[model samples]
Target: MSHKGCCYDNAVSESFFSSLKRELLIDTSQHSAQQAKTAIFEYIEIFYNKQRRHSTINYCIPELFDSSFS
Candidate 1:
């Protein structure tokens, strides 16, 4: 957890939402709740986790980074 009212504490989450807006929601504003949920799930699981290279982890796919610990 982080101190209350500290934006830095939430920087990672904020960055993610910013990316989601730019990459996924820029043109669309409306969707059924179920559709929105499914889209987010696919974005995070299929694209973000599996394919997006994260700079914070030395430009590695998250799954690759995670497997190094096992």
Candidate 2:
């Protein structure tokens, strides 16, 4: 296993958390860890992954992207 304190070992994870905190966490002020978990889960599952539009996905939201692929 890699050393515990290596900063380079976590670059991707840090980037992901930075993006998440910048994009999602800043929009919310959750009081509890459980609430934050649930809110993040819903935002990713119900909104971002399922309904949010991505330019990389050809301007269609995820839900429509799947249908168009069929």
Tens digit of per-residue lDDT, candidate 2, span 1-70: 7998786899866765675777789999999999999988987778777776776788788888898869
Worst 10 residues of 1 by lDDT: 22-31
TM-scores for every candidate against the unseen true structure? 0.69, 0.66
Q: What is the lDDT of candidate 2?
A: 0.80
lDDT of each: 0.86, 0.80
